[model samples]
Target: MSRIFKVAVIGGGIGRAHIAEGYSARPDLFEVVVLCDIDPVRLGNVGKQFGIARQVASFDEVLAMPDIDIIDICTPPSLHLEQCLAALAAGKHVVCEKPLVGSLAEVDRLIAAAHGAKGRLMPIFQYRFGNGLQKARHIIQQGLAGKPYLATIETAWNRDAAYYSVPWRGRFATELGGALLGHAIHAHDLLSYLMGPVASVFARTATLVNPIEVEDTATASLEMANGALASLSVTLGSARELSRLRLCFEHVTFQSALEPYAPANDPWHIIPNSKAAATAIDAALADWRFVPSRFAGLFAAMHTALVDGSELPVTLQDARNSLELVTALYHSAEQRLPVDLPLRPDHPAYGSWLPEPFRG
Candidate 1:
């Protein structure tokens, strides 16, 4: 297999960042061949900024391009399912942003479509690629962290009326969900990535920060499948913005940097339970190999997976797991009760998680 894969980016907003990461960071692995968006001015501006000659308004144009090997879907959440299905049908691999789809049924359908496609669907959970998190995972895998005990994840950031001026920002149908789905998703996903699958969740949500229909503040208590306990707090109303994660195990406690956007990158403080544990952690991490964080790292891993016929860096199942937690959280908040894991189709919120009038 060749080392390089051609890519087409849909949606101009976050699509510009994906293009830059592909072309600037790992040129040998990815080529940004096309850019698509409904807005001509924004599309042309992004194309010129990135030196991309092909700028089109229709996604079909991207799907029809024979040389594009992958489609990076940076579009709004409402468009993700249809776009992913179309790309897979066109025999191109896909990389999608978070909150993969609005409902569990969509995830199931996408999983089935992926099974028959020539290429695979990879959900973008780039925060999981950072060296700090990777090092933490390594320590845990080596049994140096010991049995997990507790974790606290906080996503405290500010998003005001101006931030939601964009057409889709504050709505449930267009952006899918609010603070829990869009803003705090990465932090929550990182929580599950480090701790393990969540067995249940009891949550509370509010829209106090903004006039948006969706919740801008939320808190959830989680029970991991392995008997670990965790708490997640999220809001778009913080005076000092930050994303923080603290995982405490039997042997050591891992604390991440307070960087609001790239908390997973570095400067993690790993506190050991005892002197012997500290020595062991130092010995284990001494042999750790670093992977570039965010999009670059995700693309590199995708290249290796494609070439070696191995698993994609982030699988569809991973997306489903994240979405399940999302569904459970919303259910718990809406019903004022704790919800169990493995939410089935028969569940009240399985088909659509949006409440009332927003269930369009």
Candidate 2:
């Protein structure tokens, strides 16, 4: 029998979205028993809205709750590592937001911490749990897509002065990164989610789109582990926001819909190299099942994993890989050279990917 996991959600900002779109979407699997926030106004507002009876402004208080089965850390990027460590130490399952930690060193430490803890950890990359991307993943996994050739992914969205009005939005100390970490992270993660591991990367980034410490405009060229090549483009200056992925393989060419927020929804231009490939593709998806998009889909999968004691929907290593890619990109952009993946501890950006001036 599957049990409803009791949750204590920390942080009121994106925390509300997690409760609304994620936990609320799966009532049978989760129950958000507590809402914790440092801000009393936000805590009261979100708690009243969600009808969560138990509200506290203490992270340690929630960590002490023996009834809480999960600690969903929706706090800012900076607070993630500390909260995650504490939550895991408390023997509660954890769900953390993206760009898991500031640096590869911190990620390694968090990974190590999770290993010794009783509770499991799942990173948020909810974008993967969608129809279009899943179908593409299914086709490729079924060996119908053949060898990967090339891919072009673009994450172009707008973030103006008003958006950066929040004290934490543009600063390196709190937000970690600008568009690359905060905005285009999901799209970039989707790149590895579909295309696989990266071998090396050459990147260039600029802050032209906004007056921010981190880069708002960036481009990267990558060589995949599978011997395929890829190009990644990200910006916060696009007039018409769009996120698109075009992947070419020996047998199939897939192009995702140009929806900035929900590119993986449906209606990908799936082209087969030959009629044989077409028939196989059709046969593969003959009994297609509906997949709930975004957080809804992600939370459902997490339930199954926790209940069945199986692998998580999004693993620690998956988060590590995403961060590693980002680290490499930042290093490449700084050095003006191609940087290889599986970065060693000695890498300059391993400790902190922030620029020298911004490094704390």
Evaluated against the true structure, the overall lDDT of model 2 is 0.91
Give per-residue CA lDDT, model 2, range 201-248, as digits (tens). Answer: 999999998887889999998999999999999999999999999999
Q: Write the per-residue lDDT of candidate 1 for residues 21-126, one digit (tens) a residue.
A: 6445777778787889999999989989888879999999889999999899999898899999999999998999887888999999999999999988999888
Whole-model Cα lDDT per candidate?
0.89, 0.91
Model 2: CA > 4 A from native = none
Candidate 1 lDDT score relative to the true structure: 0.89
Looking at candidate 1, the ten consecutive residues that score lowest on lDDT are 15-24
Lowest lDDT block of 10, candidate 2: 177-186
